[model samples]
Target: MPVYHSGFHSYVETEALNGALPKEQNSPQHPNLGLFAEQVNNSAFTAPRSENFKAWQYRIRPSVLHCSEPELITQHLIRDIHHKDSVLTPPTQMRWNAREITEEKVDVISSLVTMVYNSVAAVHLYAANSSMDKSYFYSADGDWLYVLEEGALRFKTEMGIIEASVGEIVVIPRGIRYQIELLEDVARGYICESQQAFYLPERGPIGANGLAEERHFLAPDASFENKEGDFSLYAKFQGQLWKMKIPYSPLDVVAWHGNLYPYKYNLKLFSPVNAVLKDHSDPSIFTVLSAPSLSKGTANIDFVIFPPRWVVAEGTFRPPYYHRNIMSEFMGLIQGQYDAKEEGFLKGCSSLHNPMSAHGPDMDVYTKASNEELKPVRYKDTLAFMFESKEPWQVTNFALNSVLRQKDYLTCWQSLETSFKEVVVEK
Candidate 1:
């Protein structure tokens, strides 16, 4: 199969060095996936990259750096992937009042997820009547950001409605209370949530090439429209629950501009990094936005993508083959069915494969790909994404117990009735 495994070393390798050297761990730009960087930069918020609290935004921008050399930034990230892993003093606890509402309550998925990965972890939730319930949560210890991956959503703030869809982003200041509404059948695509605050990926080599160029990340232009009314705001106070009543909508932004904004970068706008010559490159080559968790250390999380594009393989398995990992991978389909698995995982459907768990296409996919005639296939219909986290995931009780969830997803991987010989090649 044409598996685009990351060429970079895993975080585990680099973190070992953080404690030994400790000198080079001062910035977020370390190339390797740094895990302890957040611990070192915990005091960043005191500097307040922005004064007071104001909304920042970015929109459907694509990288324009393809023609230029990428090895510069790529090498930096790859080298940094081998930093030291020192445990932080301790992370401040951030919680929200997320309770099971229905007989089967949706376990509010809180408790900061990723540490900011080289890969972008984005979720486009397709929920019905599911209000991401009024909850207050924040990384008091670090700045956090959220971007709408796709579809429409209403950010339910204490003030009022902050609406967005594909190519839109919302930067909820740290220690903020926010909820969401799926105005559309499914609200989708969440990005840049983790210990490492999401920032615009540096365009070191791109310089003027325009990859994720600033102009494309359109900030919110609406004026601060004010509203007054009774509203209830819930806060995650010291890992406990607390509630208070407020009298207005906080999203009444008339106009604003700042780097600390929420914006979306359309995947299509991505100046896709493709191979000039034939050979598979790591999917990091497709990274739209990368947040480095490791400051003085290595990366905590990586948000990368396998966007829709042409598939070129003469005799290789064009789609992803089956595999598993130690990291938790939460995957979602963006539009149509993926080239690998034409069935299941509908556009709005999501699948969670925890650490060390086996995943990848089911048995049927293997059978089909092995014998199917080779054709220059273009993965034109869909976008298959992943939210890979360094921290092991705690399958929410809801996820663990939802009927909508397929407990027997294992059936997808049932062993094939027959087997084929492995293709061995001589060096």
Candidate 2:
């Protein structure tokens, strides 16, 4: 089992070796134990104190020793929405069935397929059968938020090791070196890459008690591996993949202290806040994390989840109402059925609603909720999530052409009938 310190973004100082971490100063003329000191800055050097994030690592070898001449690699399935060759579809609703895991052995990096993306964020799905061996990867373009949907994964990072299974998530800051090791025969998951760093959303009127508590987020304790061999380093930079041969393992940090490090949070620990007696609360109430954009209230991306919760709304439709919004939404089913969707939507499946695209309960869900008795009920075993963003997501060429794309998804709402009743009133 891996040990973790409790708290979200708290300053953590951990050392794998005794006296490996420097004391009284971030960097000293001669660091303790002859370890090289290196600092990683995630934000502008002069950013606000609260927003600035940096980490100092005391490692046996500097990161510069882990690099060599880079070679370009082909990752055709991975794409950028703003790329010249990216495809833009009309504003519409779309869904895709779960992709079949390949029988051929592949690692996490080789299995990634971009579903949709914008300038600031991208959504990707991956299914891998083999663990990365003597290989490590880091994304210079953005931080990665991993949502495990099936099987388990062990992330060995420069700072420490984090293991996450289904119903959990891991957030790795951009430029953090890590390698994914499979703990199961097969692993499938969703990845949200965002240029903006994810932060806990502020609780205004709801106060500090409800919704993801700070203590539930866990950061790994210091751990290091002293190994040298023929290793490969992969980097996703400027929307392209690059590779390089390294002579030694990069996960050699013996000690580190900082607020910027990879961390994991179990989704089950999320304390959901919702409507109790009236109508359904906006999905924002279920946000687990938000990546803020330049706009004040808007978000570059909001990772929201609809977990099992009590439904006690009276004299109101129990399911989500029909609506359109400015934010583009990419939704995925982790398990069970989404309340607003009766069929077609299944575990591992995904859907997209571009900006201002009308989407809501399907015809079956609407009809059932319309006549159902209004009583307190518990929604059990259901887990759905959405990657909501301020910018519209453009479909990747591979996603648009995938066999998993459900071409008949729009028909689910076609059966909705016009139930308007006009009554004459006394004038």
Candidate 3:
């Protein structure tokens, strides 16, 4: 799927209601700052403050984040809210909280982001299906990557529904409402909470030559709607949760026009290439979606993978095509096995490859692919992905505190050796 870097609207949350001192109220004591503050005394807020009335002006407002997240928004928000008057969790009971944060360090990582949260984060994912419920599709405020490791999901969102397989992935951004129906007797996947929005992998000198392509991304065909029903919606606002009852299907926007909207693409759509000469190419060739960073033309994180592709670089040890990156990369495997980590890495497990930290397929896979025949070979059954980031992702409690995580992943490469004799060495 084509991915692009995205960020918060900075103003979407605060600008609309801030009662800043407006210029109209500016009388030497105060000056109106923005639109919301401009209407200060207009009743939407309290009374407008005049520029000249600084010292005599106002009483301090309480903390906005102080109340349960849901209450904070509902008290002032006026929009098409999905109210959950049915079997929905309460507003204050959404997911775990980020009480105290701790960061982890690794070497040779991709610019990709791979984060695991234990008792305090919400686990989520994204998927593209052919036949499922439209109301099952939803969005969120942060990045939610779903790892399909166990069964299949007859998933649905605004984009439509399909049967998602075990190796597939599904992403749901904050604020969108979606639901899931199991096509199998059981449905399970890894829920990756990307506090950072996933974006398009950055284009360096290679430019658009690699990574996810925009045209590959598919959006909902038409705004599907439930025209005349009073249904309940489970809205997870801020961290607080609440239910909103509306007269129509929440997904009925007809057509949306914004980079902020959600879309799903299968990694199976990826088109990869190997070299005809010696030396392997970059892992970025496997990029799916990327979220850009605050830096000028840099990525916050790039979702790359080590999916099955040709190992055609002639004369060079072909696996991974080895090297370091300015971007940190985190890699994970699904199904079969990854050549780079044939011995240690396993399904449902992960590894961190930091910026400048050099990594490649294990010495074994590197040597075998290098020495093998040069004829075109199609690698199947292997599925690996990377989460590259411009910044080092702070390892959350989920990654560190969970029994579901592997602490030994840091030492995964301890047994790699340099004894492959068949593959030709690069000059």
Q: Could you say which candidate leads in lDDT?
A: 2
Q: Identify the runs in model 1 with alpha carbons over 4 angstroms from their true place.
A: 1-151, 154-163, 166-173, 176-192, 200-213, 236-241, 251-257, 275-279, 295-298, 417-427
Give the top-scoring candidate (TM-score).
Answer: 2
Query: Candidate 2 — which pairs collide?
Result: none
Total backbone collisions for each predicted model? 59, 0, 97
lDDT of 3 by residue, 278-330 (tens): 66666655667665555776665566767776655555655555677776555
> All candidates' TM-scores?
0.60, 0.98, 0.57
Instruction: State the lDDT at 238 in candidate 1.
Output: 24
lDDT of 1: 0.42
Q: lDDT of model 3 at residue 388?
A: 63
Weakest lDDT window of 10 consecutive positions for candidate 3: 34-43
Selected candidate, larger lDDT, 1 vs 3: 3
lDDT tens readout by residue for model 2, 310-338: 99989998888999999999999998889
> Which prediction has more favorable lDDT, 1 or 2?
2
Can you tell me which runs of candidate 2 are displaced by over 4 Å?
Answer: 81-84
lDDT of 1 by residue, 276-369 (tens): 3344544445545544554532234555556667666666665565556655565655666765566666654566665666656666777787
